[model samples]
Target: MTLAHRPGGHSAARRRALLGRATLTWPGLAYITAFMAVPVLLVLGFSFLTRGRFGGVVAPFTLDNFARAVEPVYLRIYAVSLLIAAATTALALLIGYPTAYAISRLPARWRTVALICIVLPFWTSFLIRTYAWILLLNSEGPVNRTLLEIGLIGAPLRLLYTPGAVIVGLLYAYLPLVVLPVYAALDRLDPLLREAAMNLGASRARTFWDITLPLTIPGALIGAIFVFVPSLGNFVVPELLGGGKTVMIGNLIRDQFLEARDWPFGAVLALMMIAVLLGAFAGQAAIARRINGTARA
Candidate 1:
């Protein structure tokens, strides 16, 4: 019998194909379930439980942890962290958009070189990079010495261990994230669209403002989320740069767990962070879809 003429042949082949795909994916699925999924489930459970007298979680599940996280003190940290993240996102976009546009205008070979330079920082350890920033921004660092020599300031400015330093560090850390996505968007953009706009009497600036920027909004949003999400929860940059003065939600969560031994409250904070991350992602998706639909229309 021919393949088409054979009853149940299509179903049998489909089952085999599905089974083959499942076999291929099982290892990754098992790993994710075991490591990520199970841990998240545990955290969720812990969030609802009570903290033990010493450390660890206990029974007598209650909703008070979530309530405690909403107090004025914790809320202030959340606000500060959000504002810092917002500033970082804005600065990254302002800096990265121009940078990505410039790189997009470069020769293809040069574009690759520029991108490599943007991402080269990742090769080093993150902690090591943060420490490097501390060395550069410290009171006796080159930045202050240069300013002093140039008569900009008589004394060395306190650059390190300040909120501004933290912002700068976050910006330095996440700028590459912004650049790569924006560059990808600009790379995918058709040259013809810009040409057509110019052909129709649009100025170069007008062409970009009208056509280029709108189309690249999705990428910019993606980059913004990329920077904002991590910046919001980043304790390291703030710790190294802000010197414990600027307490972010991340630091608060860490202290609750390690110092206060309040695992339940820490889990609540973690859950809140996760929820915010999800919201950011969902909003990005919704905005991207809306922009895409608008572009198509």
Candidate 2:
């Protein structure tokens, strides 16, 4: 009998294909379930339970943890974290877009070199990088000494252990994240589109605003999320740069868990952070879909 003439042949093939696909995906699904989904569910469960007298979680559940997370002290920390994160994202966008644009416009042979320069810092440990910043931004560091010797200021400026230092640290660390995505977007863009716009009497600036910028919004948004999400929960940057003065939600969460031994409250803060990240991702996805639809139209 021919393959088509066999009654159950097509159905049997479809089943095999489905099974193959499932087999391929099982490892990833199992990893997520075992690590990500399970931990998140555990944190959610812990958020409701009472804190033990010493460290761990207790049996009886209560809403007090969530309620305490919204109090004035924690609210202030949230506000500060939001402001810092926003500033970091904005600065990264402004700086990274131009940088990515420049890199994208480079010769094909030179592009790889430029990209390597941008991402070279990632080869080192993040904690080591943060410590390097601490060295550069300290009162007696090279930055202040250079400025003093240059006669720009009377005395060495206190650059480290301040809010501005925290922002600087965040910007330095996350700038590469912004650049990579924007570069990818600009690199993939067809050169002919820009040429056609220019041929139609659109000025370079006008073409950028009308054609190039609009097309790269998705990439910019991706970079923004990359910087913003991590900046929001970053304790190390603020701790090392701000010198314990600037307390972000991340520091607060850490303190609750370790210092205070309040597991429930810490879990509550963690859940709040996760919720913010989820909301940001959802909003980005919705905006991306709208942009894609408009582009298609």
For all predicted structures, in order, the TM-scores are: 0.95, 0.92
lDDT scores in order: 0.91, 0.91
Expressed as tens digits, the lDDT of each residue in 1-297 for candidate 1 is 365578998888889899998999998999999999999888889999998877887899899998898899888988999999999999999999999999999998999999999999966688888899888998999899889999999999999998999999999889999999999999999889899999999999999899999999889988998899889889999999999999998898888877999988988988888898889889988988997898789
Off by over 4 Å in 1: 1-12
How would you encode candidate 2's per-residue C-alpha lDDT over 1-297 as one tens digit per residue?
A: 365678898888889889998999998999999999999999999999999877798889899998998899889999999999999999999999999999998999899999999989866688888899888987899999899899999998989999999999999888999999999989878889899999999999999998899888888989999999889889999999999999998999888877999988999999988998899888988887987788678
> Residue 25 of candidate 2: its Cα lDDT?
93
**Given candidate 1, what's the lDDT at residue 25?**
94
